[model samples]
Target: MLGAHDSTRDAGRAQRWAARLAWPLLGIVISLGLWALAARYISDVEVIRAAFAPQAGLKALVHLLGSGELWPHISTSLQRIAIALLLAMAIGVPLGLCLGLSPLFARISGPTFQFLRMVSPLSWMPLAVMALGVGEAPVVFLLSFATVWPIMLNTAAGVAALDPAWMRLAQSLSATRWETIARVVLPGCISHILTGFRLAVGIGWIVLVPAEMLGVSSGMGYFVLDTRDRLAYDELMAGIVVIGGLGFALDWLARTISSRWTQRGKQG
Candidate 1:
C-alpha cells in the first residue's frame, strides 16, 4: 500500500508539472499561428509572404546563429546596456539618497527633475547627437538618461518610505548619520531599488534601438537598419525576434531577482 501510494504521488506530481507547462506552450503555438496568418493575409505578394513568414524568420535566425554573425551584434548591444546601467546606478543612487535625506535639496531640484523626467527620452536624440557627436557616446548618453529617472525616483521613494520608528531607534542609539544610513536605510530599501532597477532596464532597452541608430557601425539597431537597407526582411524579422526574446529574458531576470530579494528580506 505504501509503495502504491508513493507511485501515485509521483504520478500526480508529474501531471502537475505537465499542466504547469501546457499553457505557455499553447500560448506560443497560438502566437505562431497568428503570425503565420498575418504574414499570409497582409499581402498576396510572394516576396512579402516569403519574407514575413515565421518559418523564414526562424530559418534566418538559425542561419545567423550557425554562421556566428549574430553574436557580435548581440554582444555590442549588451555592452552598451551594461555601461549605461552602471552609469545610471552610480548617479541615481546618490542623488536619490540626497533627495530622500534632505528636504532642502529635494525642494530645490524637484522641478528640474520633474520636468526632465516628463520629457520623452527620444526628444533628446537630436540634441544628444549634436552634443555628443554621434558615436557610442551619444547612444550611451541617451540610454543612461532614459534609465536614470526611474532608478532615482524609486530610490528616493523607497528611502522616504522608511520607518520613522527605526530612524528614532538609530538616533536613540547615538548612531552616526553614515552608520544609520549604511546599517538601516539601505537594507530597508533594497527591494524598492531592485524594482526601480527593473523599470529602468525596460525603459532603457526600449530606448536602446533608437539611440543606436545614430552613427554606430554595429549593435542590433544598426543591424536592423542595415538589413532594411539591403532589403533583407527575413533577417530583420529574426532581429526583431532576438530583441523581443532578450527583453523578455531581462524582465524575467529582474522580476526573479526582485522577488528573491523580497522573500529573503522577509525570511530574515
Candidate 2:
C-alpha cells in the first residue's frame, strides 16, 4: 500500500514538472521554427554566397564536434575568460574595499573611477595592444578592463551597505584593521561580490569575441573570423550557437553559486 502511494506521488510530481516545463519547451520550438525560416529566407537571397541553412549549421556543428575542431577554440576562450576574471577580481576587490572603507578616498577617486567606467573597454584596444603587445595579453586586458567596473562597484556597494552594528562589534572585539575587513567586511560582502562577479562575467564574455580578434590565433572570436573569411557561414552559425551555450552555462553556474552562498550566509 505504501509503495503504491509513493509511486502515485512520484507520478503526480512528474506531471507537475511537465506542466511547468510546457511553456518553455513551446518557446524553444517556436524559436527553432523561426531560425529555420530565417535560414530559408537567407538561402533565397541572390547575393548571399553561403549555404548556411539550419541543415548546414547542424552538419557543420556535428562535423566540428566529431573532428574535435571546436574543442581548442572552446578551451582557449574559457582560459582567457578565467584569467581575466581572476585578474579583475584581484584588482577590483581591493579597490572596492578601499572605496567602501575610506570616505576621503572614495570622494577623491569616485569621479575618476566613474569616468573611466563610462568609457568603453573596446576603446582601449589600441592602447592595450600597443602597451601589452598582441596575442593573449591584449585580449585578457580588454576583457579584464570590461569586467572590473561591475565587480568594483558591486563590492563597494556591498561594503557601504554593511551595518554599523557589525563594525561596532568588530571594533568592540578589538579586531585589527585587517581582521575587521577579512572577517566582518568581506564575509558580509560575499553576496554582493558574487553579484558583481556575475555581472563581470557577462561583460567579459561579451567583450571576449572582439578582444580575441585583436591578434590571438585561437578562441571562439577567432573561429568566427576564420569561418567568415573562408565563407563557411554554417560553421560561423555553429560557432554562434556554441558561444551562446557557453555563456548561458556560465551565467547559470554563477547564479547557482551566488544563490547557494547567499543562502548559506543567511543561515549562518
lDDT of every predicted structure (CA atoms): 0.93, 0.92
* Per-residue alpha-carbon lDDT of candidate 2 for residues 158-224, written as tens digits (9 for 90 to 100): 9999999999999999999999999999999889999999999998999999888898899999999
Q: Which TM-score value belongs to model 1?
A: 0.96
Please, what is the TM-score per model? 0.96, 0.96
lDDT of 1 by residue, 96-209 (tens): 988998999999999999999999888998998889887899999999999999999999999999999999999999999999889998898788889999999999899988
Badly placed stretches (over 4 Å) of model 2 are 43-50
Q: Judged by lDDT against the true structure, how good is candidate 2? A: 0.92
Error of model 2, residue 173, in angstroms:
1.5
